[model samples]
Target: MTKEWMNWYRETLLIDAHNDVVSKMKDGGLDFCQRQSATHSDLPRLLEAGVNLQVLALFAPPDSNKSVTLQRILSYAEYALDCVDRDPRLHLVLTKRDLEALSPAEGKLGVILGVEGGDCVGEELWILRLLYRLGVRLLTITWSNRNALADGIWEKDTRGGLTSFGKEVIKEMEALGMIIDVSHLAPAGFWDIAEVAAGPFIASHSNAAAVCPHPRNLSDEQIRCVADRGGVVGVNFYGPHLTEFGSASIDDIIRHIEHLWNVAGEDHVGLGTDYDGMDIVPRELEDVTCLPRLVEKLRQRGHSESRLEKFMGGNFLRVFKTVLPD
Candidate 1:
């Protein structure tokens, strides 16, 4: 890597919008504080990546019992909290003030909690508030199946959008200053969020459907809606999302970014490396430590420093400060 890129990587407020570290650790009985080679995230690796802020997704399987899922997720949250408490290099970011005070240069990894599916809240809106109190500032309305709020990509055949409860959830989330994540929601549900949401909402870990044509990927129009609403579209690094084939390389990732930058504009693009959440990753980006290499590649591709900064973390940081409550 170039010295200039290394300096920028260390100095910039690098934010990864989505990662499934918590769920992976819980399922695999892994330790977050140790150097884990089998997984994509660990305290030491994240810190070494110079990750200023990382959103660790707390996901429950869609078919699981809602109450049980919530309890398990809470336990996972507690474990993560305990880990943070024991380690001085880790900080759990619960408020906008915490985010504002973050200085990655100080070597602390500011961690944010995101729920991958709203199913954990069951049919009760109050449950959403309860999760918010527990430090989950971002909520993905669905996973790959139908839920109380809306249908996921798997339910696209219904062409259904958000239900009455889904609209209510969006309203309450906005009032509470929690970010509405539309990553797994079906296209119809995505449009529903775009229409009902008065403020910005993000596709926390989606790529360009126009490029890869995956059901999980966003179309050009959807990308524009996100940008138009001043929300960021975090680019997912999973190979399946990046290409028609199952395998992908760094060029494929750059291709998605180039397309997203065109469709959504520079201000709305950011990284959402779905690390530990996917089985396959681009060869060039094997783990979090390879993030700087991607930056260098983007630079070589002719992205200006300012645009690179936005794509790297500035865009997501802007949304976080706006949506995260005090």
Candidate 2:
């Protein structure tokens, strides 16, 4: 490939680590949920952007009662895949072979399911097994509220971090080959996970707390812990997590990428555009189609083409390769 074509390919190989497309699609309910032209991430946009791997999140807020939430999220995931099945051009990856089968030649976009919080399990181990069986590969222990598993960073009590139940949950996920996600976990909760998590894991959609100071973001120590553990951190697009100053811009986004690539190293840093979850995106890097511009910025900064490829989607794919069961 020519240098120009190589740059084009490098810029577009995105693996958006967290997206609420399914949850948003469910807002319209079963009957009226077919059209995705309404959201930021529809099948067409992802393909148009050449997004190679899409992490579709089964996101439920803290209050979603157990039995009801899991059913809804799983149902939403199934429905999302249903759309892909109907489209002959779309490819939804569920196995190692399916991942290998995809190429830019065969509609590069590949969908993977992730649960954004453990509250949906509702103290039921069966739910974890079931969700995994149903194709959930990444599971977060908590959202912004305390749960049977762990305290969220936003939990008011903050008295406890990971409860006794949380450890079991982590172990269960480990044995099942599911990636433990620490994005919204409390500080102590993060440590508990870092200590006992038997396999590779990640903070799917978070930024450096040292830069942003938001409870939702990870501290420098937290970033280091994840990196040292051979894990990756997908720096979030949300401005609140990206900065303590004023409104955010593309520069803020690049700087965070620079900082994360510096601190976490290029192998351990990637993108988790919380596109549908946040009201705003970084300037210039607005939607799925705009992601290529980021690669240009990285190139202008003198990032090698190969390292930039890892940042785009290679890092996340590497983690998935480790966590996905044979």
Candidate 3:
């Protein structure tokens, strides 16, 4: 048998469900193909970090305090796709096969193009179809503020439910086989989606509200809600999300994982470390390469190797496999 050390650092594929690498890459004055990384993640760093799948968000913060036009919206997605298409190393993915095709040597990283907010398309459903056709696999209904699609966690959800247009958007995404992401949706919007989204969905980069009082997390009921629908909640590793005082360490991250796993069951819990998206991370999980530390920690916490494997990668992969279109 191989030494325990040999299998200890298992080549488990790490997938951070949300990363702002594309935009930050742009900020570093590097385009997709040209991104050499002066910042958090680059192609080389991702490989060094032992990542299998990296979700690159097409985030274009509105130029105005409120970006109220379709023309200005989706520019980031359009450009990000162009960047991906230009780089043979990056493959835009909308289906499971696209993910299966990734090769590190080829610099071919699996990129699931996701829009952070549906504000770009306004109330029109056609834009979703266009975005899907453009290779977007996931859509977060809202970001920090309310929009035509849904209310964001930052905003007070006066409506207390999904709007009529939001329901229609969900249907379109369902028909198109796109995954509905609820990271920033308000409580009302969250439940509204649970009722309408036909297929299972995910909170791509959210934590348990019980762990952190942040508006961005799923409440205990919300956690159960997503799990009941066969969806996974990728427990976030952001320091703020994992700690109640917002004072945290990697241990806090583990607590949330253990908590979510215990509450949501093994199959429905996974990691969605919102790298680059959050300013603060647990001290132990400082960089991508430090992920193995988390595995060892989980082992100490009485999580069997099998459970660790599932929590680390298997769960997210399962969700992705289930949600990807035929």
Candidate 4:
């Protein structure tokens, strides 16, 4: 890396809104603190990439029974906390103040715990509260399947939106100051959230469907809704979401980023990466350590320093500042 590039990266408050390293760890993968060749991210590489904050997702397969899912989530949450507790370089971010204090230059990696699916929540409001108390500051309502809360992208043909319980969950989440993620939610459910959510929400790890036409990617209208609410759409690094052709590359990622920027405006775009959660990634962005290359490419594509900052982490920081607890 160039000296100038290193300086720019260190000075920027880089944040990745979604990563599934915890799930990988749950499945006998390497710990986040260790460097690994088997997964997309780890602490060593994240530090090398100057990632100031990383939101680690607690996800279970959608087909698991509710009780089993809940158990798995709890275990993941515990493991996440343990990982942070054991590492001096990592800090658990639980409030807006914690987020505001993050600085990549200070060599600290802020960690935000998030639940990636609501099936584990079942029909309970208290469980949601418990998750908040346990320091989970974000929740993705569904995971490409129907749940007590709502239908996911795979169930779009059913025209299902938020169930009554799902509406209540949204309200409670807002009351608790937790970020509601709409990534895998079906179109009906996505609109339902736009109608019920009184604050900005995030499509944490989704791309623009208008660019790639994947079911998991958001449509132009969905992107506009998120931007209109002063929310942000995180560009997923998963290849299928980036291209209709064979394998993707960093340029494919840029294509989706440009599309999201045009549709959602500059301030609404950010990176989600979804590392360790996907089977394949763009060749240039194979791991977290390659983040600087992506930034360099964006810079080469004529993105100004200020716009680069927003796309890197500033925009997401603004939303977190607004949505997170005091």
Give one digit per residue, the lDDT tens place, for model 1 in 226-248: 99999999998888899989799
lDDT by residue for model 3 (130-237), tens: 888888888888887778888887775475557899999999888888888888888888888998987788998898878777777778898988889988887766
Candidate 2: which stretches are off by over 4 Å? Answer: 1-7, 10-12, 29-37, 156-159
- Per-model TM-score, in order, reads 0.98, 0.92, 0.89, 0.98
Q: What does candidate 4's lDDT look like per residue over 175-235, in tens digits?
A: 9999999999999999999999999999999998888989999999999999999999999
Q: Best to worst by lDDT, what's the order?
A: 4, 1, 2, 3
Mark the 10 consecutive residues where model 3 has the least summed lDDT. 63-72
lDDT of 2 by residue, 171-260 (tens): 998888888899888888899888888776799999886677788887788888888888899977887878775468878888888888
By summed lDDT, the worst window of 10 consecutive residues in model 1 runs over: 60-69
Pairs of colliding residues, candidate 1? none
lDDT of 4: 0.92
Off by over 4 Å in 3: 1-10, 31-38, 62-73, 100-108, 157-159
Off by over 4 Å in 1: none
Error of 3 at 112 (Å): 0.5
Give the whole-model CA lDDT for all candidates, comma-separated: 0.90, 0.78, 0.74, 0.92
Better of 3 and 4 by lDDT: 4
Candidate scoring better on TM-score of 2 and 3: 2
